[model samples]
Target: MPEGQVITVTGPRPVSALGVVDAHDHLLIDSPGMPGQGFADVALSTVEARDGVASGITTLVEMTPIGLGRNPAGLRAISKHSGLAIIAASGFHRDAHYPAGSWVYDAPVELLRDRIVTDLTRGMHPADWHDPSLPLDEARAGAIKGGASYHHISHAERRRLEAIGAASAATGAAVLVHTEIGTAAHEIVDLLEAAGATTDRIALAHLDRNPDWELHAEVAARGVTLEYDTIGRTKYHPDSVVLDLIERVAAAGHLDRIVLGLDLGARSYLRAYDGGPGMRYLMTAFVPRLRRRLGDDAVARILIANPARLYAMPVAGGAASPG
Candidate 1:
């Protein structure tokens, strides 16, 4: 693979090709943690993805980690059908997303680390590593996904984080960590850094759930990206809250560290399922408002330039194999 390219399901492409990105989102996810809420239909996903594309999104970073219904082959099909660049994830989610007797809970650090590296450099396991004998999917995972508990990191979660950090260190892949309601932001970064992942390659998802500008500014100052995906999530708070936080963070001189996404992670969150906001909400609804508040240059940076930097695979050895 060449330098300064993003590893998408279709194959590697130049960073410049990723125009206007949704830095965090999910196209296929099925987890016991959210009962009866998983969406796996590739046709519906392609429909939703096309809507997003029509609304001005060029790429989507699918953050459904392993064992949480991450279908790489299905993602590839959706990408081809929808004309959307999809960057898949490899790693694990929080403890709640896995079952009590699942192998993810007991897998050692080395096994977990190798799985992630294989997903990045080789291909993601079609069965999410449930059956390693199965052939690998042609679509490769471009980024790593890991999560922490609410203000705490469990034993299993800690092990997974260690593995994620090691894989990131070895491959120079970007990592996206799910922060529960935005808790343990600094602590998550600390552990990943201690495990050899650099702050620049780390992004804390759902940081807007906390909505603390001071904390966001501090984290951004540390060279870590802050992903705000609460757009149109009225259940959490109004879009104004996120807008205010972005303005404050930008004022604090960390605008370059901010990225935006809708994070429509559930079936009910998609318009194809007769849901509200859908994937188009970010670009069609909130982005116009964001442009009014911050002007086109800042919005372009948030929607385009920042994601290009955050999701770009390291221009070094260890990136995923070309599809």
Candidate 2:
């Protein structure tokens, strides 16, 4: 692997080698908590990544962590078959995504840290389900993700965040945290920094849903990356609304701290499920809108430069080791 390489599911490649990147996305999301026909399909994911490549997206960050059906082998297959640089996540999502009494809730901090560290260094098969027959996965994680609940960070989530922070500090992998409606963004940063995580290596996802310029500027001033991923979903806000927010943040002199994502997790967001806009929506549509609004230089920063820098692991080889 080369220096300044971005870790993919297959291996690490140079940052300059990457083209455009979707900073936050869930290539496949399958948990017991997700509906049966909601949005978990390898075939669909293959098309998603492949189609994005057609429109100039060279990389994708898969934000589905452990306990959320983070199919590492599935991700590897998608990357192999699609020829896309895919980065898999290792950590926990919101507590509601898991069943009651799951190990994520009750596991000791050291245990959680070791599990995430192994996923980063060695492989990404999370559990055996009390059965000895299941095998470990060969695909390794490129990033770590953790999250809190609505309006409050629970004790369990905090413990997991601390463990995730420790794993990140050890591995130098970027941290993607789910902010419930964008609350506790600063608090999350404080906790990760307290646990020895790097502020520049942290990306707070879904803050665009909240759409607060002052707050976003505040967080970006702290050296954290902000990912605005809810594009093409008119149910939220128009694409221009997000573009406007980006303009505000850029004008605040924090342009380097910004990134983008498609966040096409829902079944309806999939073209295979008649989700028309598809994964190319960002590269094809919103990016053009951004270019028109913010010029090609800013476009390059958000889609190419920002993500490559943020997602690069501290110790780069192929997969990062917890050394």
Best model number under TM-score: 1
Q: In model 2, where do residues sit more than 4 Å from their true spots?
A: 1-3, 126-135, 318-323
| TM-score (C-alpha, index-matched) for candidate 1 | 0.97
Question: Which regions in candidate 1 have their CA more than 4 angstroms from the true location?
Answer: 1-3, 316-323
Output the lDDT of residue 96, model 2: 75
Per-model TM-score on C-alpha atoms: 0.97, 0.94
lDDT of 1 by residue, 1-323 (tens): 12388889999888888998999999998987898899999998899999999999999999999898878989999999999999999989999899889999888899999999999998889988999999999888899999999999999999999999988988888999999999999999999999899999999999999999999999999999999999999999999999999999999999999999888888899998788789999988898888889999999888888888887877643464422
Candidate 2 TM-score versus the reference: 0.94
Candidate-wise lDDT, in order: 0.91, 0.83
Tens-place lDDT digits, model 2, residues 77-178? 898899988888888887877889787788899888888887788777645222324665777788889898878899999999999999888888899999
What's the residue-level lDDT of 14 in candidate 2?
A: 82
